[model samples]
Target: MKFFIIILLFCLPTTLLAAEFKVSGYGSIVGGKVLSGQKDPAGEVEFQVDFYDYAYYDEDWAWDKESKVALQLVASINERLDATIQLVAKAADEWSPDIDWFYLTYKLNDASKIMAGRRMLPMYYFSEYMEVGFAYPWIRPPANLYWWEITQFNGLTYLYNFELGNWDFDFSAFFGKETQTKIKSHDFWRNRGGYYFPPEGVYISGTADVTWSDIMGVNLAAANDWLDIRASYFSTRYTTTSDIMFFDEIDTNGDGIADTVIERRTNPDGTPIRSGQWSLTDFDLSFYGLGGSMYFTYATVLFDYNYVTYDDGYGSRFPTFYISAVYNHDTWQPYVGISQAKLKITRDFDGFGTGEAEEHQIMTLGLRYNVMPGAALKFELNKFKDKGDRSPWYDFSYHNDATLFSVALDFIF
Candidate 1:
């Protein structure tokens, strides 16, 4: 990887001389430890390192979970056209480089433009800069609100910028599609006698192909000397097809060959098991967000609220909100934030049996120190409380509360 980067750096000057090209990069080296938490009563506290899902945290000062590096190259093609390519290396994937954004921008007018190719989905105020730690006030964004299955879409976007009565509006309409594959382990079968079965856990791999049609969104914001306000609304029709494979190797019948097994869904009391996979074809999801910030000489206050709902009545209605304050003193900035989320699943569809609701709250305190011209150091402490039943996707045995401590060095060049 170092060699690859060196080669790119050496060739960048030549490219810049030939064409209007610019290169920039950002990276973060982060380490974190879980002070306390466990999923099961007898289970030991361990770090939850989920790279694909950014909500999880690292424990024991591990670097191969949250660290990442990104490089972006923008090339101007004539006066009205430009191309950008961004590559990212994440610790969760062993630092393997992946293309995050590769797009072409065509200027239609002074205030209107068109973009084509793979780009980030503008789901939140910080969506475009979510990977850049320096752009935010915390070690990371609030996980309760930022967690999503998709981050990027491959398609086209039309953006128009205009001023409306002393307020600036950035309106965008996008059409895109995305496909993702996720792999995880699950407890396939449990013994009635409370005995551990052979191969206690089975790996379940699934692929989700989603198509987004008629996706549209608008963002409006205005700022005065000390106040800023913004609101966004996005709606889309989502169609998805999924296939799952359960790697079950148990020879329950003592036969010479393994038997095909299907997943069983049970009620909260673990009775009346139903067989087969849960799948959804076409659905709709709408997102709404409102946020603002108040700035003073040395202190700032920020607050945001977001709500999401699915087309199917059985799907959960999720609402999240956060409030934070930061004080800036020279090169050091100290901040504290509180965030909460509520998940309420409407139990109307029989396809989704026995929906469970969950509630969570988190408090974070952190400090950021500008170490140098293009680098910053940060330390953060987070306390998480799970107030309700565990979400289906999360571990069933998670504790009620957990504490985490993290420190990171972020840089942009």
Candidate 2:
């Protein structure tokens, strides 16, 4: 964070000194907590949503989980070329600044453009402005549908805009790979595999790195005055690895009972040891998404759906979706939504597929008050219920049916 903050301080202002530079920023000061910990009969005390494992909540309120700030810089080098850079710092990762958007776009015509560099992957309706909390009525994006942590890629993209009768269309396609060298992958599921049995919640302090390569995808969005629709598809070669050892119970007969111990790593004397490592390489995975929104006089209705599948069956066959409705009033917005996620199938090193059709849903109620232009104050309540017997996806897997409260001050500058 210090390193990126140094760049933001020293580099952004220097770019602004150029003749065609423009600067802007956005941020969210948010706090949230788990309210129903006692209601969790098993006494698991912490909670976290998908992908953001680094940030979580417990019985006490915490601001560090989701607060963040970002600065954006745009420079028009020439009439046909432009450079954009956005640096974001998240409190959860100790204020580490991420180079979220460091891309250059070249205008081919009034309606077509091409870009190369780093940018957010267009997976959802609000992907481009995901970090700008003031843009959305809710405190954050819906967790179930927006679960993946790999939110961006470094590559080249082409975009075209056009009109077809009553609707406007945005067409975009991209091919690239993630620039992050390592990502946490296998730890979440393995810790929950031994449901209703002993030895659950295996704690292993190590890295489970996931990599995506040869990525190609397309997004198409169409909108009119009152309605909009979007669809996207992506295919990539996924690889996962870890340098540590992996351990699990043997259940070869699929009897849901441990017959023996499975070991992959050995010590110097040939004794087995590990920290939960699995190797799954060169597998093809794909994502499918669809979304629609309808605007009425007093209310807006929205739905988003996503599905992910792996051809090798080593990855999680995840499908998630959500629907929401927001009521707009004078300086006030109230919303309600339901979101769900299903892990149809996911495998571990010992053939212990923990998230085997593991399912969960969240119901949310939130209100947004416009504090002023470019700012808003929001309150939200969410009820999380796990439908599967395994556990809620978190560092600890003993809790279920948790409720959380959140408050936030969001602004743009």
Candidate 3:
């Protein structure tokens, strides 16, 4: 099935060349070794299942090889429209033959363009072309800012590029739904019934409902020979799923006074009230941010900061920062950086019952060598520490004093 799709995409009509079509792919083989007494955070964490095992390790401290392969096809049908599709293969066979991107773009004019179908979110770098790691300076993009899971959305986009006086500006707005799949994992909290073992919770279950999401932003940048200044702001939000509750006051056994605690149920009478599973109330969320990058001779420097706060009374705030520099000498690029993340939990959690706040501080250093123009090799090492709550459920105390070493090869054609 995958081979057939690739063949069909390549055979599509295009006027770029009279009788030739384009096909390109790249692969990476990676290994790593590490030493630490802490448990593996990725493996034991109950909330994040797919992100675990991202680090390579041995029985005590060993290295494992991982691979990533990508193929892309582009067909220019006319002067205004072009079609593109990208397929990816990875180390996990269960998730293999993935569709990285597929979209048809129409150029409305020299300054405006519109794209439809499954596309990358235009909100951040390393998102549109993340699999091609060779284009980046780090072995992996900073985990503090880039959680690096599925940042893509299936939707429509409008982009406009223009120049005003001395500054170049580009603005984009997008609306669409995020594609999600059922995650197969064990959750002890959801299996209270003995007859059937069904998954539970929004963070753990795969059958979580879908929601409409949107992203809109603008970028303003100015550059001379020695200095460049750029700044951008992006906002994104997800619609609330049906059956989601804000805060519920429940009264059981026909009692007039409210006695039970529920996050989404409200009671007028004293009967035991259970909220149905399909009430679409308001549970909206949003994030606002500003950041920039700077480039210079021999080395490129970066400093970025962003704050995300929830709209409702839940009171969740995430403040993030990343500062790093890399020097490229045609053959080798060496880099080092420090990143910090603070997750503030204002409303006390009830179900999981962890604590109030969580914080993470990570320091990273790595180097990338250009084996060739289109291919590169990378070696990365990371050390992470958690502050505030030392609970295993919240902090990485499951993986307490954690360290990791990884190597990868990335390419583009």
Candidate 4:
């Protein structure tokens, strides 16, 4: 692996292009030991479903582990244009490969650029730097603050980044599509509460029969030494044959018949009557986020406020914030941060979904101790607070709230 990295680095053009070729990568292993409080009727039920790249559990001692590998190739293909290709693969087991990123960039200058293939969306403050492991101050970005939106898009993007005095402005326009065999609900986890699940082959709201479709959006941002700001708007149209599921309708299939109870009728004698309406109504989802960060020698403060709304007319709006302070050393750095996400369902679909809009928070404190020049060990404690209605789990006690203690070794080559 080292030899392969070295050869790839040396063979790429350097002087003529005046561009440099370099290789960088990061990997880490995290283990969690979690404990819970008296079960909260409104907290997470028994969570045993796999989420994204992490594991789930019903027991207090379940540990979550993950590993990843990546490669970045940068070439000064020419003076007016430079190119960068990044590829990453991650796994919890040796058999499967998770392709995280594969994209090519073309730069026109410091003020403008264009990119094609698969790349990160400009949705948040950390979007562009999410994978730059060494640039962040946390063991991992605050999950609560991230909202976990899918980041990669396949298509074309145009961007412009410029600076006026100390203030820097960033703007972008993008278009792309995602294809799947089964369309899954973007809010699949909303109804489930505390537990999160990886979206697989499932028709969303019974509408959008095909698993995927295309998405297009525009974003704008500006940042200075002390403050940062961003805003984005997006729209997606499903290209499936399934019936569209609305808050009041659940025609499970798009066959043009009303299979749900509310839309059905009964005769005067109480005999049931069928209604013909098996199609789901299609709608769009809109998102808006604004936030910034402040830096101090003794501490760094970051905050983000976000809002999400569905076109069907029901949605959630929330604010996620983070603040952390670090005392740097020649070889060891210790830091602590408070992260919180408070979402308000704001509005609901009359009789369709239950539970009032509420807030959820997680407090974490951790340390990073360098074991060597390129390796370090980190330990963190997370406390969770759930305030809302209750739900049942597979078999375990109700999960009102919980705490997790985790430690990991992070390294690079």
Per-model tally of clashing residue pairs: 1, 1, 6, 18
lDDT of each: 0.70, 0.75, 0.56, 0.55
**Tens-place lDDT digits, model 1, residues 1-413:** 23534565576566556568889999999888888875434344543333234334534567666799999999886588877889999886688998888877899999999998778887776676888998777888776667665667777888888876666666777777665443221221122111111134332234344556666676676766787877888777766544333344556788856676545333459653222234343678888988888899999988888888887656767888989999978689999999888777776555544454667788999999999879989999888787766545244324346788889999999
- lDDT string for model 2 (77-100, tens) is 778878888999988668989777
* RMSD in Å for all candidates: 7.9, 6.1, 9.0, 9.9
Error of 3 at 42 (Å): 10
If scored against the real structure, what TM-score would every candidate get?
0.77, 0.81, 0.71, 0.68
- Which candidate gets the maximum lDDT versus the true structure? 2
Ranking by TM-score: 2, 1, 3, 4
Q: How far is candidate 1 from the true structure (C-alpha RMSD, Å)?
A: 7.9
Of 2 and 3, the candidate ahead on TM-score is 2
Model 3 lDDT tens row, 105-167: 899999999987677654444445545677677665566566423366676788787776666
By lDDT, highest first, what's the ranking?
2, 1, 3, 4
Off by over 4 Å in 2: 1-18, 38-43, 179-205, 243-277, 280-282, 314-316, 346-356, 389-399
TM-score for model 3? 0.71
